[model samples]
Target: MRSRGCAEFSIPCPVDLRKYLSESEKCGICNLTSNYICRFSMKKNEPFEETLGKTAAQMSSQKENRNCLKGPLVLDFLFAVLPYSAAKKLFDKKFSIPVVSFTNLGVLDWRRLDFGNGKINDAYLATAVKHPPSFQVSVSTFGGRCALCSSLYATEKNRRVAERFLDGMIQELESAVSPSSHKAPAKSQNNAGGGSSAQRQPAGQQEGSDSKGERADARDKGKSKSKPKRKKTVHQK
Candidate 1:
């Protein structure tokens, strides 16, 4: 949202309380989730860490106050005393849907989803389709790797924008985990020594060379019969 020029926005995050329930209170197949909306503002060129800390603090406060449980309690009281139509109307008038949302579905279990045939290489959870001007991003993990999926109502222009947004998000996450100092030397070496430097480069020393000659020496000594394999799967909304 900040990247799209929206300085302020609110996102509703679902809070599941099933794990907090007593064993006797654990009813089967029921919706035990509520949510709290967190409003945030992004200053120009703000550091990601500052934003992350603020978000964490807000969520912690909400959790400490048991805000998630209050939503359900309020709804139950409203529907209990008021007529169905009156309650519905009141709820609609009081709450407005947000334009942006995010959800994390946590890790997926491959064994449970298995069909007993081909292996489940990778999987990601996708959010429900949202109308124009509304967008949602969901994440899921499988095989120790995280996957992101997005959903939105799109025009040709909106589709292109969504693609670019997701791409930028991926790059941002990558940069957060892998620092620039770790990435720069490999790119510099590749540029300096031409195509031959790439094939003979070792995984650990890819970003370690100070000069072209050192890079050439590392490349020559680091040759292996088989290169490490990397698997990447991309899912577009």
Candidate 2:
């Protein structure tokens, strides 16, 4: 209840909207305490909210629903790597765009429309991580002509960029390959076993040290288990 004295003509009356407490009762004491006590116990207060706010919560919910729609949306578009010649062949096969002389077309950089086609705002050949192990130049399209990159390699730069881009991608993936660096744990895993590699570590080492040590200890643990089985058989014999 609001902390105000209950003596206002405009005060809402629960008895009925049309009824009012008598003017004579303004000074006369009735059961203000009981009335307030009953109201507090019976009535549920409305939850408090900021006076002014624009909710991003509703907008976020709407965005999530829209994301569920089929195919990639404009906002969800991603760069894909494909061979330059293959990409050109695809465009040539699908669309009627010509893949003739390189000089007639303006070489695309960041600013210029990528291909002469009005659909593509820009085109470039660059190294990317999308293709791993081997470097191969692939055409990239943005804005509109991105759809046509598969059919034609229009500019000299496009071909070179594609080649360079593939080179870089291969280099990046290869760099991640350190000799003897097995990506998976060497130990055999069980179908129902819940234990992770971390859990296999001996108790004394810190987690950081345990990670490297676990691999080294794998063979030792196997030998230890086999030793226990052999010892039991020897005792029985």
Candidate 3:
């Protein structure tokens, strides 16, 4: 059983979503591809949202289940169809919305998800810049604990602000859930978000690190299991 008052306690969650697009142009829409969003919200939370909010979430998942992508794709099409001025107007209007986009990824038994190797312990969803909002809040539950990870893609000043905001939210959540167990760790920043090279390291760094580490670990295991060679003494006649 989990400790009584430590249910809400959690290690600090860190994410750096600011990725300057220098050569994303390979995809044609690279310049405009900055607007990235993740499926952070869960299916059950759909009912808690307001009118348009709930409808968008439900429709997207429902269409996805039906082998259709039209529901969410329409939003992209709308942006594409709008004139430059109209698009800018829309952006300006949305800029007034909350600086952070919050959503939950539902509960996942990540402990059961394995890649023929070690199982996954925890996971978080982070996305790149999309329009005015520079931050996105993602919630996920694993091993019976809820984790909130937020990503930020903005200028240095804005990045600090967003980071502090996330830290505050984490504290608030912990406090609300279990006041006695409220002990927040200091936050650390690693360019590596979610341990993905695409997110943290350079193109090849992630693979390189993982491969080297795995090889080293395997060598250690092999050494530990191998029996020491016995030396046979030859009798001199």
Candidate 4:
């Protein structure tokens, strides 16, 4: 860009780069088009920290469902990528979006996502090296913990740098959710479903009685141990 006498500049809108494709798609109720992607620029800046803060706060507070970062970002990619990639054939110019993409799949229910064989161990995101974005970040929360996963396409010369960048992000997040700063969860909501102490009184009393029996059995064993063994004189015959 500096060689072109500009502080920042973009390459000749890579035209005909993706010419072997269609411009529209129809899937059930979704009718996707390529018109919007032709002039799209993925360089738009979104304050990640602010977005993360709001989402985290809501989740921690036990708020309702949040169709969060993953839904919008991934759905947009699903609807747009193909059409945009095919734009080179339809028009003379192909569009650009963020070189670096980020998506947060907030707190998923693994039990529901399971497919009977077993539960999902983990989930991840990735990108193509031939694609514009060289780096991407994907986040998800599960088992009361957060996973910050990243993907990067890099050559030997830049692989270390990419690793460092990703490591830095993970370290920062770990610091944010440090154990010392973490708060204990409030009383379980399960207790509200007629499972409170009053409702459990009978069970508790039975358990207390069981414990008393156990104590009595223990006392009997002690008494048996305390009794001196009867000595039998050996008969000469």
For candidate 2, the TM-score is 0.17
**The candidate that achieves the highest TM-score relative to the unseen native structure:** 1
Q: Which whole-number lDDT from 0 to 100 does residue 208 have in model 1?
A: 30
How far in Å is the alpha carbon of 136 misplaced in model 1?
1.0
Clashing pairs in 1: none
Q: TM-scores of all models?
A: 0.67, 0.17, 0.37, 0.36
lDDT of 4 by residue, 49-144 (tens): 544454455444432332223333454565576676564443333334445544454666655666878334333223223222345455555433
Candidate 1 wrong stretches, greater than 4 Å: 1-9, 20-32, 181-237
Full ranking by TM-score: 1, 3, 4, 2
lDDT of each: 0.57, 0.25, 0.39, 0.34
Candidate ranking (lDDT, best to worst): 1, 3, 4, 2
The weakest ten consecutive residues by lDDT in model 2 span: 228-237
- Of 2 and 3, the candidate ahead on lDDT is 3
Better-scoring candidate (TM-score), 2 or 4: 4
* Tens digits of per-residue lDDT for model 3, 1-237: 121222221121122222322555344433231222323323332222232353356446543442223323554676789987887687676534334455555666543464678534334344433333545556665443444444443455654555555555544444434455434445543211222111122112322224312211221344433211111010110
Better of 1 and 4 by lDDT: 1
lDDT of 1 at 83: 100
Query: Between which residue pairs do clashes occur in model 4?
Result: 42-96, 42-97, 42-98
**How does model 4 score by TM-score?**
0.36
- lDDT per residue, candidate 1, 1-237, as tens digits? 445445785668877778678999887788677776777887766666677777778777777777678767888899999999999999999856667777778877777777988455445566767667887767776555555666555665775565555545554554555445122232232211112121122113233323322211121345443311111222223
